[model samples]
Target: MVVQTTNNYNASSGELWPLLFNSKMDDKKPCYLLCGLPKPLECRLPDKQGGVGSTRECVSDKGTIQQRITEWVPGHKLSFQLVKTDLYFGPCVESIIEQFVITDNNQGGCQITRTTTFKAKGPLSLVVAIPMFIGLKAIHRYVFSNWKRLSH
Candidate 1:
């Protein structure tokens, strides 16, 4: 068994993650991580307008992360834990924690950086670790693209 992951973030003025964290949409529905999965997009996210909240919805079956608010510093930083992607494998995937920071770039803009670290709980996690890391970077690209579209 092997795990592969990739990660990265883009620099921008306004922070999209913080916006989602503070959104007041109906049902408090957050900007969820879209699972390339075919089903009801019930976005896995915490229940800001419902019952007991869990750090559960921040992961998807299609190698993605969603609604998670682990550690927050208002406008400074936030930490989100992504749930494992593979659900059937005996070892599955590793849980990854992403630390996002928003800072002044000294150029009249803000730099948004995301640092992700992985922790394997079971199975042969090293065999495909590279691929898993790459996958994370792939996802990060999508994140930025979406952010760009939303910002515009």
Candidate 2:
């Protein structure tokens, strides 16, 4: 199943995309703490060349999520494939695809959309989707809100 959420920000895609790519620019506190990496998170910034095929890993608590950049377009879009994850429901999750899209809006700012595609192992695994999406939505909103605020 695919879950998508979009939020409008009072910032241009040019302003937000660069921050998303720059590891040093992210200083917002993470909201989700149940299944992701532990406290002080460390991320490696992707190389230039559009960052395609670059990977980012996060380790927290006792879990870790490793994501690879599958597609990247500066000031436009970024997509990732969940290469590995040891989260709360890792065994039930078959695969995941995450994407972010930024586009200019008529409101003079930009619209940022986050899309996550999840493949479950079976019917029981599908049941876990609800809570997973709820947690994800919260984290996304928190991150986007911080991004918007920082863009000012």
Candidate 3:
């Protein structure tokens, strides 16, 4: 299953990409907690200098998840796949891949599209698909709002 969201900003992709990739998840206050999940205590991304193959680790009291960068295109696109996760939801989720693409608009701004693909563990895991989609959409909105606010 996939959940996608998009938002436009009055800033260039170059201006907004850094805001999303160069910051800690805790600072962004990722919206997972709003979905009845534990808040991440720390989210350590690789140095902004790394490109593809770089890794990021997010830790919460519940557990930690590590992601590997699969694609990187500076100000245009960034994508990663979940490599390992010990979080509570790991048992129900098999895999996750997320991508963010930014493109210039005719209005002299940029639009960012975030897509998240999810693979459930089994038939039983389908039960939570709706909630997962809702949570992911909320997370994307929260992140986009933060980026828009900070781009100025």
Which has the greatest lDDT? Answer: 3
- What TM-score would each prediction reach against the true structure? 0.58, 0.77, 0.83
| Candidate 3 structure quality by residue, lDDT tens digits, 34-100 | 6566455545675646578998665666788888989989899988889999877787888899998
On a 0 to 100 scale, what is the lDDT of residue 74 in model 3?
85
Model 2 C-alpha lDDT per residue in residues 1-152, reported as the tens digit of each score: 77788988888788888656543325545564555523323334445434788875545445767889998888999888888876766887888898989999899899989898987777777587776776667656666666666688
RMSD of 3: 2.8
lDDT of 1 by residue, 60-128 (tens): 333333435577665566666654344332154456667667677666556566677765554556654
For model 2, where is the 10-residue window of minimal lDDT?
Answer: 37-46
Count of steric clashes across candidates, in order: 18, 4, 0
**lDDT for position 43 in model 3:** 50
**RMSD per prediction, one decimal?**
7.5, 3.4, 2.8
Compute the lDDT for candidate 3. 0.78
